[model samples]
Target: MLTLCLAVSAHAASPDEPLFNLPLEGVHAFYPGDDPAFASVAFDDGDWPTLLVPGKWSESGVSVSTYVGWYRIRFVAPDDLPAGKLALELGLISWGDETYFNGELIGGEGFFSRTSPQLRSYAPSIYRAYPIPVGLLKPGQENVIAVRVGRHFNEGGFVGGPVQITDREPALERAEQNRNQAAAVQWVLFGIDIAALIFIGAAYFGGVRGALFWSFCAMWATHFAFIFTNSQLTYELGLQSLMVSWVGILLLGVSLYLFYDFYTRALGWGRFFPMTVLATLCALIPPIVFVVRWADWPHSLSFALDLAFQATTTSTMLWSFFCAVVAWRGGVRHAWPLAMSGLVLVVAWMAVALFASTDAVLQWGGIGVEVGAKLILLGAGVSLGIHFLDQSKRLARARESVLSAQTEERGRIARDIHDNAGQSLAAINLKLQSLQAKQARGDTVDAGDLEDALSFASVASRDLRDMSHDLAPAMTADEPLEVLLRDHAQRLGEITGTQIDVVSDGPPELGPQAKDHVYRIIQEALRNAVSHGNADRIEIVLSRQGGGLKVSIQDNGSGFDEDAAMQSDGFGLTSIRERTDLVSGRVTIEAKSGEGSVVEVFVPVG
Candidate 1:
């Protein structure tokens, strides 16, 4: 059990009453130097102005104009003091501080050098309890205590609760409990940031490398740094990196700008220039703010820079909401979810700012920040999932279409073979049987019968060859496209008894798939000219036109109406159009009744 004493009453404790409060009404302050004699009990600090203990120098009814300051407190100890190791509990000190009891050094934290005050500690709100030596206090007599504090920026001095002296064990235990309670929220937030990092890193490296995912990942990483830097654990562990928090703040603006950029693109709009300008301002402002505070400039300038930073950050959030509404109005999918998430973030942050003056809200362990991040995560995750699902559906539909086309083509080839070659072979088989019967019966066989049999055999061979050509020509990969086209034209001319001419003017450097599509388009066109248009002569030209491959097929046939040909249920022109589209090529057909017809195709080359 530890005896308690309060510093607010200024009363010395008696043995019968171990618990009493003492007020620090005699605390005095001096400015601008770190003289070693200031801590001595014999030094005269009575001429210095009185200052309020457990309060900031700015609020202590005194003007402090330098980075180093000192405070002295005089207290009387009871003659029958409690026999135990004691400690001086200074609730909190800003920046850095050191304390002395009865002209002797007790304990202190942070660098107190007046020449290099920038290297001082900055855990301004942490409870500090330093152990007091056993023989330091004089019974029934005045004891002097001195404190020196070094300020880097912002308010300085004892800025927490009242100071007191108590048993070392219980004082330290209470400090530990307070520190833990104050830092509990920061630990939880840090854990949330870690989990977010894992999930985003896994998603990015796992191939979800979209603009949204990467931007969100970067934003979360910056947020993590901000939270970690501000966390009490980082200070408790003595890991302070200068200007790291500012860097996080700077990157936050860039991340928000990137989100807006990606959002506008999703809505089919180009980059928004105002957002770009705002992001540039965000990147530029933080460094200025950091430098102003670091050099300990005028408080007015520092306040202005701080205000600018807040304004920019707040403007970014508001701009994001505006973009979301724009996207929603444009009918972009998942925009409403994102808007709702942003709404939650805006409301939470507003609450944080609104209740900043009250300890009740500040002590919630930053639930607002955590909840805002979680909501954004939910929105981004849902959006990504929906995008992936849509991509999968499109891919599946394309696969199904390709498979259906392949099946339809195979059936077309089977029917052609069965109808043309099958009948021709049957006629040839019957004619051979008749010739064999005549020879076996010893009857006079006529030359006409042999001639008829030979003709039927020729017809069957021609039909089989045409069917083979329709399936695919026997050509090597290295064969020139013009050679294939000319060969195909010659074969068609032999069957149709028409004059076919093929001319190549320029190189058509195309891939294998593109070449196949071109060949099919030409085949379809040639068949249409002969079978449908009853053409007698056909002319084909291959050339390069305007950085693309051009193929033109013309025939002096009794041409049919172009619109009617395209609209008819026949597969000739329809197949031509389909093949052209497959290769990302364009085709135009020109025809008139009793006039010549032309089919021209243009395909781009890499």
Candidate 2:
């Protein structure tokens, strides 16, 4: 007969109530069935050697084999041993073990001994449980517990556990609570991982070109796989599976790589090839470790490699934090959310490493941190999604603005050709025709007339040059936005014969696209002030305010109804509004029948 004693809970004792505790190191062992007197209360032979309970004889450096050793404990109860329906719990055991309490057989895990040569070893994952009836324990009395173990490998016998005596009810309740908590966390993590996968899949398949999103999904997916690998159900199946551990090891490696890879991409640092190599190494470690492990590698080597893998994981997390900090410092606002999530997960890992890494029951740390990890990851994903969404919206707006600017540019080019270049060419043609007529009639050609022809040609060339510069200002490439604005103002001033003042206060950095839009808006405003209002003097102001750029162009000219201008906006003013709106900016126009007009624009820096 084989029986297992199962304890339902890990914490049944209160702070003030101490239970009867026994040390395993003081146990005595003997050859099983060597003598029936071994079970007698006073029949301990002086020659019997000591053996530690809750451990193996081989691990204790003793020369022993299967079907030969017996573990016995002689312990005296304290005055406070609980008086109730007490239960005994011996956590997971392997190979074979038979339990004897006070010279009576209570439980066993396998069939063994001289009377029965049959051996039935259960899977290492299964816990052997037996019920201890009430009134079976004596208080304030010496008690003996003996276990006869039969197994040869490290996976056999009582490897890591405690033989505990606990009150049945509280322990059972606690066990149920743990199961419920674990189930809840597991379901939550599964749901989140699935949802994340779906979301990332949608984004990836929807033409998101970046590698960041899918790699991010892989990271989460691999973690999800890792969770099940540590599940007891998986562990049990793995006992009979050749590929379970291998698959798990491979997934573990991939997960690690994806984690680090996603972090690298999200940080958007330079494309460091060596980081990928390092990530590959991280990805390769688990499979290699598992292969070597299956090949009977040295235990210490396996331990060292496993520790290295764990260290790398922690190091990657730390490096991620560092990268996030660096990114934030470099003005990547998206990094803030990553840093926060990383901090939480890092602390969770630290707590898990400190307290729960070696635990067999729940190998993924405690439930609290497990739940915390899920929540942190979920929140991080949401935050990242929002960030990308905002960036996408901005990009779309910028694209629209650029397209509008292109259209306006084409129209301006056509206008310049017709108004300046074409007219000059036509006048030069007229002058040449007149010269040809004078030569045909033998009339004298005037030097003044030649100079006038030369002057018209020069004006055409000047117009072409100015139009080219306006179309694509070389200064726009590297000059500060204020410089570009000043140049535009100077050019407009020359044409209008009006004094134009450009003043810059705290000129904020702006990208080329934004600068183009701003310049065009100001140009439109200046054109209106001159052509429509007939402005004498103009003032342009550029400044930064609240992490944004502000532009104001004012002119002292005859003004018209502001509402009418907005209602029946000319092409130039409409283009100005479109450009401003595309950049998610605000624009205002103030004008009256007599007062000067002011056009003001505000655009965000983000």
Candidate 3:
């Protein structure tokens, strides 16, 4: 049985060890070769696969291009070993890794460019194992260990220690703690991704540049979901392991494409679209290579793919930078959040990519990968939060604008009534008082003159009532708008001495604004007909046609030219046109000399 015990000091291979002294040709020789005493696995290699010990691939004569491959090492536990826990320590895997001890699955880790190292630390919950349990071993025999490693572009892997055996509980505890921490980090990443989706969805639904934002967000969510599932933080739906691992990278490419679209539109970088398309296409290259024959591709090709990945990431960063600069230059206050959030994301991604490429720090059970992923995720969260806040502010501004407009409209109505209708009413009251005084003093008064005065007074009263109704209509509840039209026509006939007829055929129920605007437009049209057109008979028709409301007002009187009327500097036509425009409606005027005019307005309510 393999027994693991704690040593007072860190375990190191003896300098005299034969494996260390072997004049291993090339970097591969230094690595535990297929020989059981050293290493026993040979992964499919293409394009210069590196054979390096637990250190920087660069030092092992392996360029960054030679990062992905299968690694195997062989070791034999002594037959006399105590039956207890045993442990194997690895430094860090670049993007992600899977390890098997003596054909028994040990653990795996995966990384995300958008997530932070801290978040990555907690990601893999299921794949993490405390220590290579002695129970997993066939006692005192040769054991084969294999590792399948994948990396991001420009990042190469396996930068720490090789296989080591120990029974130390402290070491085992530390390993377990790391695995637990990684699992936690993964959960956090998942949470942040979920939050991003919700925020973007809300932004889109709220009419805040939703299409572009949601497209980018959807792609990101898909990519992260693949990473989470593949990394064993969550259960994977059935698929080959290699396919599962590479799927996220493929998704990342797609996300970057959408992100480019969003960023370009946001920043007004129209010229970048071609480049964005190119980058998206370039992203497909790696997946294609992997699909064609993942085993046959040299490490260099994989490295090149990693470089492309980095390039894509860098392009996204550049796009973000451009947006920040544009916003800053434009003096848009809201741009700062986007700029800062983007900066954080870029910086976080760079830090992880750099850490993954170097062994400046010790790797004890995939801690580095965890740290990098967490940092990226934290940055993503910050960026997403900023986006949400900006959207909220924009909505607030739009609502305020609407409210301000409404307030100004009410004020204008008040002033119009105060200046015109109010003064007229006061004059009528004075005339009435004078007539009453004359009658009370027994002064001679003509009955006809008194009747004329009373008629004038009645006209003033009717005008005042019409003005009041115009300011605040009695029907606040939704009713068929035809009711309001009929009421208006009746009032117009009583006041103008002109025969007014309102005809309706299947009029649709209108929203408040639509109803209000139509009423005001008709009121204005009637006023113009009486004061300007000198028309005796007016016909108002309200009907629905082609999913819209059509209002027509025709007058039988001597008509003026349309151009002359428009140049007369009157508010009636202008006001009607403006109201119709507010609801994206259209207006047409048909009039000529000696013929009555027809004003046709089509208002879309939907």
Segments in model 3 whose C-alpha atoms lie over 4 Å from true places: 1-53, 63-80, 83-85, 89-158, 168-172, 198-213, 216-220, 230-232, 235-240, 271-274, 292-295, 352-355, 360-606
- Which residue pairs in candidate 2 collide? 3-108, 4-128, 4-129, 4-130, 5-130
Collision pairs in model 1: 6-22, 7-22, 9-22, 9-23, 10-22, 10-23
Best by TM-score: 1
TM-score of each: 0.55, 0.51, 0.49
What RMSD does model 2 have? 13.7
| Candidate 3 Cα lDDT to native | 0.56
Misplaced by over 4 Å in model 2 are 1-88, 92-181, 201-209, 236-240, 271-278, 354-376, 399-404, 411-424, 435-606
For all candidates in order, the CA lDDT equals: 0.66, 0.64, 0.56
Candidate 3 residue lDDT tens string, 385-496: 5655654654455455556446656676677667776666677677778878889999877786578667767766766777767677524746567777777678767767
- For candidate 2, give the lDDT: 0.64
Task: Look at candidate 2 and tell me the lDDT of residue 154.
Answer: 27
* Best-to-worst TM-score order: 1, 2, 3
lDDT of 1: 0.66
Model 1 lDDT, residue 72, Cα: 84
